[model samples]
Target: MSDLRDAAMSSKAWPFEEARRVLKRYQKQPPEKGYVLFQTGYGPSGLPHIGTFGEVARTTMVKRAFEVISDIPTKLISFSDDLDGMRKVPGNVPNAASLEEHLQKPLTAVPDPFGTHESFGHHNNAKLRSFLDTFGFEYEFISAKEFYESGQFDEILKRAVEKYDEIMAVMLKSLREERASTYSIFLPIHPETGRVLYVPMKNVDAENYTITFDDEEGKEWTIPVTGGNVKFQWKPDFGARWAALGVDFEMFGKDHSTNAPIYDQICRILGWRAPEHFTFELFLDENGQKISKTSGNGVSIDEWLTYASSESLAYFMYLKPKTAKRMHFDVIPKAVDEYHQQLRAYETQDTKARLNNPVFHIHGHNVPTSDMVVPFSMLLNMASVSSAEDKETLWGFIRRYASEASPENNPTLDDAVGFAVRYYHDFVKPAKTYRAPTDQEREALSDLATALSSEEAALAAIAAKNAKMGRDDPLPEADFSDPEFLQAIVFAIGKLKEFEPLRDWFTAIYEVLLGASQGPRFGGFIALYGVEETIALIESALAGEFTK
Candidate 1:
């Protein structure tokens, strides 16, 4: 078998193990058309947070694993329960004036306070889709609104009617155990109409909307109620949906572990198997608060993507074990670099012999090497500098530089190029800009300027000397570093620094370095951006006073 396949087979990732367990559990059962992997979450009443990505990303990982091992088709289902009533007005929703009226309406029908969409639910749902697509996640997205409108819940409702007493008792028991009380079972109430629209529960004889049971006193009484048709009442609902969909695996935050038994109960009720569960801890921000959109405390995937690539984002997600550990964005760059290094290591055919392997290194006697590569930001910066704006360029860099770079390098030359481009394009300060440089940053710049003076002078002398050489003559890399040429580079960088606000500084630097003012980073930016562009930008930055 190819090493990649071998590695995948030996993988310890949750997806792999959960998929195997699922396959074995159904090994002799009636053939299923396929397994469904579910990621369920409420639409953000506020901006969607990074935790939202955790649900989908982890589920997608398991889905891919099923495809890899079991030949069992896997469908990633993103269940957006927008039909659920709006509980609290999300901060992002502007104009909270009509919120009270919106309480009973399906979230999709609720008007956005911002007045940007037909309803607040519609606006938030769009943000969720946009966020998922930004990460290239493929899912069979289903809204509770559509499921209700389509009457998929008809059979479920009928079943609830037949088992009404039992289901209610179970739910009520679970609720009481959890120290909660409910006057009515949670049902999807049509936002437009205050009435509960019943989808007939299949195979159950429900008499009207009333169910009756004899109390301990033996006097039978009818209670006006909607069938406890919703997934699970109490906490077990999560498990019921899991079994209903044949989910092989699902993850939850640490807070949900107390309700784990609900999964078993739901499985028994449906006569379907339960999925393996992995409980990841809550993500925390730098300030030590648990990451949450409700609290306005956590960074969202949208925010992270502004500084990192989708792969890098995925890499970071996979860094910790999918159980009981929290992560912050500040530590993400390192994880991304490590993942890149691993990819590079996987590509090496003679990896065992290369003591100088850039992607991996021996840790101890008779020990296998571990992978470590440049950060994602570095690669991105490189792409930003180059004319090429695609993943292929970045991938090629990994393949080509598998023998030279190391993680110790803050941003390798390649990374510098990528980071420069990314910083310039995405976060570049425009108009009036104030860049407050830390003491360390200032020192680094001063050191770079001094180094540039000699490098420029040397390059200038070499260009003059090389002028006599034919265009076809072989160009030596060393010729670009003659002392006089190096000095000229120093002068240019120094001159460029005098330009006004940070925007002007970057513009002048790029124009001199790459002949493009509106492009990638300057120092590491040019070097990592693209080799060809780096050379071009060097020439440009050398030119005087960049302006329109």
Candidate 2:
């Protein structure tokens, strides 16, 4: 047991810990469904956001960990509650005024305002599928409309009919009197109006699997619990779906944590043990407000992929699931760089160390090597200093730094180069503010420029001397692109000019040359941008060119 399996079993990583808990569940006997089922629920009231995709990504991580430690087969279901009634028309969607008439109808029943799909629910569900597919999530898609309408939920629906009073007794304890007075487990889909009627049921005929309820107009109607006649109210649906599918694990946002016991009790009443559940802290926008699709407060999943790889977004989701994350554009470059950092670290790790790595959970057994030569943050800084308008302009510098690299051979680097350009225009370009250097700063920068110019002159003399002796190889070029060498030169100048703490020197360099208050290491920037170019930039800043 001292091998990879032993390491996997003892790993303290969150996904492995969650998986071990599940593995303990079926230690005596495998599940009757022949596999452990992991389910993630989605509400199709609006287009899916980056946070929506995160739920599936996190669940997949746990599912892979479970596979590592247990022999039991596993399955994942990306469930959509499309039968949920549209309580209010969202202010963001097109033709929202036209959707008012359809309020209280199941999302699947309302006509799509977008003129795309047959119903609004389908439109949102399609978007959700596309978002998940973009990340290559392996799972089966189940729609609530299809599950209930096709009679797959009939058995559980009938079970709820038998246990209706018991379930309501548990639910009423959590609700205020105003809500408890009219709440019923069954919400009947109106046979005529096509709206989901929320009226209290007068009687539950468990023997016949039917419900009798009064509609809004005080009209009496008796409908079967089976088929498309009725759907469970959301809270009951939560547990009933768990019982119906024999789910072993599920996860949701922390907002649902309070209702977890109710879901468990109802599932028990329906003759199935509750699934193990995880409640992750809600994702937030830059302002710390909960991220929402309609509020449009954070970057959409597609929008994130616009300037970064899908893997970087997945890495962000993989980290600190129990803590709230601010999902904004500014987090992209850091996520990209950190993901590659992990990938590089993975190359040297042993079995035990690999088990705890996020990339292992993220990629499962199919982890791909990171081909990014330049860190993404460095690339963004490069974009700022170089003002690269196109990927081609950045590629020229990249090819110089990595002599053997090309777009075709280094696709990840190529993609990052393009991302840097787009990110610069959208974010950095808008926020940049330039200022002329202070008296001490200007003097120090001039000295640094002189130092580089002096080095260039000495190199020219050496090249001429070597030509006279026919040693035209030019003394092996001194590795001028090495960041440490360039950094040493900058450090020497900062000390000679007596800049307190030395960081002040770099700060002035950023503000004057890049028009930003902070930047990447000045030496590394020079290494990538070329020594001569940086000297010219320093000369340009001393003349107050950027301040103008």
Candidate 3:
């Protein structure tokens, strides 16, 4: 434990680095609240997106890292601002027009478009919980509606009333001069109608913990700040929530980087210290646009899981998080293969190196060994060649190469086979462009065919000679299954033909055979797809079977 803690103290992994910062918070003394708290805020205006899932996933990494470094009890809050007014209806939901009548009302007060939950907010909150729950995140869900109405935030709301000028002074400095005139710290909800009232306060009665305001109908009313009567504007809410929860750590996107100071100052003004803040760059789509839940330009959690494992998605989230990433369907195969590579590497890594390994943090001491007998990219290429329409068809080829492997014994690999078939049909098959091999490539490919034929004849001769000699010279175990041996054969052939830098030879194989511009190692492909089958494929390509 001491050794692990020491390693975490100096580890360069971002999670560990953030955990070290959290540890510094309590270095001088234990927390006043008796436990360190990590909070992630969610606005349930729309279904939870990948970026939302990322916050919980990434924060869990830091929290897990902190657990390794300290014995302090830790808590993570997945807080939802479900009480926030519906500023605009989301464009993607079913029956979008039905929500038009309810704009400006609290999300919890709006009718659900999906007809699943009590309100739109509940529907989305349920989704966010199910999304996090599906990935096995440990967190407590807190609804802003419940938090305020249940009087959990009563004291803080009153405090905001008492410190109105100090908090507003800090807030007004950030807003434009024209907008500052009408802005108030407290936004009240109508007593009769459910819509949130955005009018400026006529007068604030700090002693009574209430505010006087005029409704849109020009009616005067003063409401107590307690029992969900009022909620802070977003900027003030940020700091107030931090103060109320004593959140030790929270992470937000770089967009919020500018407003972090306002949150901190409000937290301090409300008589609580600010939490540690982590600013991660936003995720971008294929077109390099920031991923927005409303725009729907990026891949969703469901779309990613369609082609890869949840662990692979988590691995993608674990990578270079401070930098923006393109979360598209095309990146899934690479993520799946690389995640397994890291898992395999973790098996032999030392304690220091293991601490630095993502899998160590992903699975801790319970890392599962990868059951993938074939790489994912290879499976993708195999799917392309075989035109596999189902997992059963792909399994036939898989069993041919690995006679011992079955879906029962290799569930992970079996899943990849299914994903391969689907991904090929969806993305690869449609995009495949089979260009004819150039003159040089044709000559090289013909030479490859001649080389394989000669090699086969020579092997047959050796076997016959061995039989005549009465020597049982069995080949090495899993000889055909070895990727390196098969790759060596192809590499030797490429060198003999002298394909110049040699990538052109490989490219010829991919374009002429797989219809892809890139592919798995051809030697590895030959090993799994069978040497005779590959030889036949080469002949067919040379015969213009593909280009025709």
Candidate 4:
């Protein structure tokens, strides 16, 4: 049988598979060290949506896989095209209506709403960096404003301009075919205030990054610089930069696949390598519509961190092939706790069975189990129990608790600490949610408790009888001794005559065992936690309350 690692590396799933094939071809000959793994982001015209992170996260997965299989180093670059002028204000941002006059300026030049940064773009960029960092994602980030203004890409731009006609023709044809937008064969260049005409491309004179456009007839011209004079049109600028950077691979949304082929043509004209492509699908909202910031129908990444950890978010995004479906927060957060549990289990000696599977090794390492630390819920629980005012004490308790959860193989204490810190700093206490027990729930808990108690007593009695006969059987006594406690719990549960659906039994059991009315499942937990602790836990839960 093939090893799990071999099975996982056998193929890269779509839409990345196409790109991976190209990478594989290159791997046969291998690209240079520091092979580029690029993921691009548009200007922060508004808060970034989860779809934005989805693109980068999937690309990161591909990059990680490539590194593991081929032993080539990758620099996953995240480019923020902040030089792209703000096309429109996103709906949810306050005071968006008043920013129309500033639309054409580079995003870096725009005013900051939070007053912490010089401009709105910088502020949002900071938030994005923080968000990605929290998720433990690593990348080399470049801002377009800095790239253009610092002249790091000057030579590339000159080459692009030298092949201006060829690049323009390619882009124009692509726009017509794909976007259906007509172009006038004129590149918009800044004109002097008194200039009545524009300079033709070849004749335009540029001095110290400033350029003046003169008409074909040499009648009128305009001088423009970063703030004033010149602007590269959308699709063309993207092509020129890719050519400059020598990018080996880049991923884009499915919507861009049409124009993307055209950009490759521009790369050919500019005498630079075009990146291999991976086209990901768009994320849809709960309503099943494409999430759009401009349309005012999207959830931001920040909004999602409230309910789940970043690892869960990343795991959820790539659990299936990236192109298979659209994702939303509601679905992702629901599975995170269980995912965390699985990760913890895999770390233990008992985990050899579970972690040995091929599916667990897909794309990247099964989220390091030893690193599966306590979540916000566990951290809060520890804090509630701690006597010291020290943050480290809370963190220490979390690490210990998480270690106990996976006794055989555990993630490092550092990972536990890191997760705990992020949870404490980033999460808000959830609003009080009390689900009243239903009659059905009462009867189920009561009946199960009663049956469990009877079984326990019967086993104990059998053990006692065997002991009197000098049989000394160890099994029955080992399994059951506290029949009375089980009966008490069942009776207590039976008192609440309400209709609780079978589906919600887990929550009811959690409530009963943990006092918060929810901790883990009842039956499975009872099996693992043992009947003695289960009874103690239940009695403590029913009487005092589950604190930690």
Candidate 5:
């Protein structure tokens, strides 16, 4: 292992440390194929949403981390359960009546309600692939229907049929008494209607690998278990897929956690071990309700990409996957800003710190040195104040503030500028509120304006004089070259007595400038937006222009 990977493996930080643990476990019992297989599953019952993106992005992060510490080749399978039956028409999809007509039919057999692709399942699968491709995720896409029809799952299906009694015993142990008598591991497909029938199998001929079942019309038939003749229930299929694909690792949401033990037992019955599993909390909306694709209540992948970068979304997923997080439009700006911050930190931090940073994993250990001229939050403030409709206007301010920075040299910042503009228009504009500063706060603000006029004025000196500030650690000598110096100034300003709680003062400043009650850190905002422009904004607020 390289020194950097060695250091990364040593750190107890999230994914890298988790990856090391997984690698060590694999090392104890190496795969026969000499490679690790990571799987992220998608159910094709609905269009791909942000939750789908999160699973793939997070799994990719782990896979990338695994690649760094070990030479074991890794492959990620983006598997789609397209053969699943459509139990009900999704509330968000078009043509609900048409979808309802196909209830209980295989997703692949149902027509696309939107009239877009060959089948409903095909439409969803194509969408899933397109978005994953858009993010440049490296994974092999596999459809359950294709695997079943192509005989890839034949061996597993036969094994399941032969072990039907054992599988049923495992499945029945956890079910309620009322439902246990009727439950069967196999769900046969009716040849006449092409619908996946839920009726119990009347008889199973293990030697012939055949199951007999009656269709909806009471017509009885027997079919071979192999060659797409039957499909296993979800729990059994989960176990069978693990055995069939040799899945080394798979992560899923907590809702399916209860099924893990059952799947493990089923896999054991098949003479194979279950893959290393991770269960994560589900994504919730701002209202604390679960985010669902069918409900269409949460942000979509396309919506996020419209206002943020893929890296931002990836970073959002990287944080505390075990804890449920509210994912909505409101979370986008912070995620975008944090992604930029991580990139900036990656450029300056040491290898150990870089390993802990999200950008290091988000880029798969190839952490990019950022040329960010300004933070995203600051760009949003600029967008709000200037009402910049295009990149040219934003670049005009960027050029004036950071003479060395330009769209040509700082592509990431340039892209962020566009995102900030869109985010402001969509999310920030509607909720903006400007509260007039109190007399005491206005006087303090005027002092800040006077200090800005001096070419050599320091933020620390201004803060100390205005608020009687004291710190256990003595302030460093004023050096404009240090970014932390600007942060300190903003920190001190926030501590001023004029705005008693600091949040009020922060709100006052943001309200005066952007008509918003909260915004980017004031020091960074001033540095990127220019001292003169900010002074003018304060003056404009005092003059009552912003209130109008």
Candidate 6:
């Protein structure tokens, strides 16, 4: 058996475990279709956002996990609810005034403001497809408009018509007294204004699958239940789609959690079971405010791609997806670092342990080897310290630290260095803070700078000083790869008791090197960025050049 198959069979990772649960549930009562369908719904109300990418990326991960464990043919349906009526113009899109002219019309019928597609819905749908395709997600795109217009939903529509009163009862139980009176499962598209009408149905011809409703002007009309003549209300529409499409698994945001029971009831009334549902919390901003597109308070997909890789975004989505996560510029470096960390871990972990690692699942069990010389956070600092304009400068430091590392052998790190350069310029450079060093701190920094000629000689000097002070742990033989060396430097300086607060010594180092009070672990930074370069940076800071 293949190594991946062996690991998957023996490991109890969450994705694999979830897949097993799904398979067992199906085995107990299998669908007539014999395969699973995973559906991800998108509303083409505005430009596809980062949240949209998260939904698809997460679903694709589960789908990949399912593929690994089972030979059952599976399909992911990227369904766009483009037939829903447009209530208002989206603030972010172009030509808001044009959209206002067609208020309440089905989105598919509204004219495209960008002139890139046939209609507003078509334009947004194209964008959604293009965006998902850019990530190379395997999904079949389905449009609600085309699904209804092509008679694909005819059978389910007829069933819903026959059970309209039963479906209405299920829907009305959840509504207030006032709303329950006017609620109708069927919303007929007005033949005159071409808008979806919410007016009460005059009568229902259950025998013939037809409904009679009055237009806004009180003109009476009757329409067929199928062929896009009518669409169900939101709750029933969700249920009808589940019944019609035979969706086996699907997920939505937590905002829809309360509606799940109602949707399930509606589905049962329509003679179909609701798909297995997973509700995930919404994405939040860095300050923990909920990200809302209308509020313009969160990052966009294009913005994230400007500074990080798509895989980094995927890694962000992979962790505890059911819990809310902050998606902002500040989260990028950590996500990139974690992605690289996982790649590095995958190289040395045993088969069972590898299965538990996210990179194993993120790459669909085909974890590729990497020779990353440094973490992303360190590279970001390196770029900042070196003022690197491009990859060459970052690579110079990389090659100095690890002579064998190169762009050709470590493509992931090479790409990350480029991203780090862009991120440092865009986010880090503007917020940098540098402080002038005190005389005593300056003296210590100067002494450290002299040792730049040989890192070992500097370690021995610090060790001898520590021994003279009768400290318990003196500096050990220099090994930059181990963080203990840098920690020892901080500890040895603290033993001098020059500063009241012991942390001040480390803080001094960070402020001098990064112009920030906190940064990458100093030892790791020096190891990856070379001792000579680190000494030069400290000397430059002491010379008042960095403060300028």
lDDT for each candidate structure: 0.51, 0.87, 0.87, 0.55, 0.82, 0.80
lDDT of 4 by residue, 1-548 (tens): 23533543454444234444545647556665456455565557766777778767767766665554454566777788766566666667667767676765566767775678888789778877877777667798888778866777667666654565576667666554644343422344324221112223434333343344445455554443443235466677667667767777777777787888787877778777777777777777767788885665645676556545566666666655445455554354344655566566655533234333222433245445434444434443333323224456654444333335432254333344344344434332232233334556545544454445555643444444455457765543323333343333333343333324433556676454443433433333344334544455444544434443
Of candidate 2, the 10-residue stretch with the lowest lDDT total is: 457-466
- In the range 49-73, model 1's lDDT, one tens digit per residue, is 7777777776666666556555555
TM-score of 2: 0.94
Model 2, position 278, has a per-residue lDDT of 84
**Deviating ranges (above 4 Å) for candidate 3:** 454-481
Under the 3 Å rule for N, CA and C atoms, how many clashes does model 1 have?
Answer: 57
Q: What is the lDDT of residue 96 in candidate 3?
A: 94
lDDT of 3 at 428: 99
Model 2, residue 165: distance off in Å is 0.5
* Total backbone collisions for each predicted model: 57, 0, 0, 25, 0, 0
Please estimate how well model 6 matches the true structure, expressed as its whole-model Cα lDDT. 0.80
lDDT, candidate 1, residue 169? 59
Q: What C-alpha RMSD separates each model from the true structure?
A: 11.7, 5.3, 4.6, 8.2, 3.1, 2.9
Model 5 stretches astray by more than 4 angstroms = 25-29, 450-497
TM-score of each predicted structure versus truth: 0.61, 0.94, 0.94, 0.66, 0.91, 0.91
Per-residue lDDT tens digits of candidate 3, residues 1-548?
89888888889988899998999999999998999999999988887888999999899999999999899999999999999999998987999999999999999999999998899999999998997898888899999999999999999999999999999999999999999989998889999897898889899998898899899999999999999999999999999999899999999999999999999999999998898999998999999999887767788887888888989988888999889898778889999999999989988988889888888777766789999988999999999998988998778878988899999999999999988998999999999988888887887677666545554633443344455557677532334456665665565556555677888889878899889999999878987788778889988888888877
Better lDDT candidate (4, 6): 6
lDDT of 6 at 446: 73
Question: Candidate 1, TM-score vs. the true structure?
Answer: 0.61
